[model samples]
Target: MRMNYEENAKIFKAVSDQSRLKIIDILSCGERCACDILEYFDFTQPTLSHHMRVLSNCGLIEVRKEGLWNYYRLNINNCNKLTLFMMNLVTETKDCICNDKSKCTCK
Candidate 1:
């Protein structure tokens, strides 16, 4: 169940920004139009576009166009994959006990 380090790093980088992280949180509930997302912050449209581009480029979020509006949503599958990767990295020895070192066969 190994994951690509580069892809995961990109996702992490996309979310590393405060604004982008806020956008991710907004999208967590459901899909949203660009204007709706823009209303939550004080930044201009172009700034929001830049954040959205970075997010979409990293595959952390998805976009769709409806007339003149652009809708965005969290890419749940990719988000879940990233979550699993983090959990696996932290719990690499899930089957191993703290008291037993030599008898461990978790791998």
Candidate 2:
């Protein structure tokens, strides 16, 4: 409950976009340049840049520049943190919350 709700919301929002999620999927294969990613879609450069910017702001992806091209890769630490956060959410909370309002001490 004390977590940074705004930051977590930003991550969720960024990944909510189909384009951004596809970008993550592309990066999962390996690090790729903007040109490579752009090739997979029919959107214009500026539009793709916009999507990339959103993903970067979410702390999910990192980009590096090489000459004129930009390479994108997943931020393993942040990704791991998000994954662990979700896992903990599922594991910590008991399933029968509504039925038993007596002794729920699993936090």
Candidate 3:
């Protein structure tokens, strides 16, 4: 399903931070426990939790609780939606009325 602009914006915001981007990259490899994820970073547990919360809230990642641990993985469905949104944003264009005399570069 297509996501609304606000939802897409949230996803963009979630990835705006370097920490969160790195978190997503880690999750991209496969599902991993929160502790395992923490090992890959130098930040505190709370900081990692914050990043995970943002990613989960934005629908960019999914989380599962097993005992005292939270496992995370990239949400493929939402990722695909985000991909389509980006593709449309970059490729969808309006027709321009530029001619040779206008010096417009739209080809």
Candidate 4:
């Protein structure tokens, strides 16, 4: 599979934060309301909102509105893509970038 470096970089950046990683772990269990997620941290609601926005923007999580509440769940497709990306990144394959060394200037 071809990888889009820029898109994958954005995903890596979004989850770089400790708080965001925890949030993803929480959502991994199942869908949750914003309020329910907020209970997991000591930060203000706005902070949680910021983290949620980052996760949402990166396509890692999906959000839905139910009256005054916003529900969140992991985007399983994107999560699986990320897993595949990581696996491809580490494992050698015929398509590996290093295999195309024609661009190499070193003797």
Candidate 5:
């Protein structure tokens, strides 16, 4: 499968932050309520909300509402896509970008 540079970049950028990385790690175990996630960090609710928004926007994590609470979990499909993308990025495949000499600007 081909990888979309722009979309993958967004996913990488979202996880670039330390806080967001931690949030992703936390959600790896299972779905967690917002309150439970907050306990792992010293940040405020608004900050956590911001992290969740970034994660959700990048399709890294998913959220659902139960009453007044919000629960979050890693998006398995997207996560697998990311894993495959990373592997393809580092591995020397027939379709690797470097294999296209015409795209090279320098002689």
Candidate 6:
């Protein structure tokens, strides 16, 4: 599904969670099975599955089943959409000038 701006914002917020961010970082490298993801975390199978479900729900990741294995793939298209939006913001807002301050709220 094509997520609108609000929906995509919710997705970014979801991925802001620590564990979820780690999951995305791992997937950023390449696709991995559910079992493989579980091996690196202290969470139980159900917990990891829940995190995967959230990621899938946000369209940040795509999933597939292969016999007894389930694989997770990064939704790079969605990622590109987000990246482009950020790039556009930086490009469009030519005079934001908040970056050079000692401390900025945008951070």
State how far residue 107 of model 6 sits from its true place (Å).
Answer: 29
Which residue runs does candidate 1 get wrong by more than 4 Å? 94-107
Q: Model 5: per-residue lDDT, tens digit, 62-102?
A: 99999999999999999999999999999998999998999
Extract clashing residue pairs from model 2: none
Comparing 5 with 6 on lDDT, the higher-scoring candidate is 5
Q: Lowest-lDDT window of 10 residues in candidate 1?
A: 91-100
- Sort by lDDT, best first: what order? 4, 5, 1, 3, 2, 6
lDDT scores in order? 0.88, 0.84, 0.84, 0.96, 0.95, 0.83
What's the true lDDT of residue 1 in model 6?
21
List TM-scores for all candidates, in order: 0.84, 0.80, 0.81, 0.97, 0.94, 0.77
TM-score of 1: 0.84
Residue lDDT tens for model 3, 1-107: 33377878878988999988888889889999999999988899999999999899888999999999899999999898898888766663442223234686665
- Per-residue CA lDDT of candidate 4, range 2-107, in tens? 9888999999999999999999999989999999999999999999999999999999999999999999999999999999999999999999998889977889
Q: What is the lDDT of residue 16 in candidate 6?
A: 84
Candidate 4, lDDT over the whole model: 0.96
What does candidate 6's lDDT look like per residue over 1-107, in tens digits?
Answer: 22256876888887888999999999999999999998889999999999999989988899999998899999999888887766655563534444446666564
* Residue 107 C-alpha lDDT in model 5: 53
Could you tell me which residue pairs clash in candidate 6?
none
Candidate 4 local lDDT, residue 7 = 97
The alpha-carbon deviation from the true structure for residue 94 of candidate 1, after best TM-score superposition, in angstroms, is 7.1
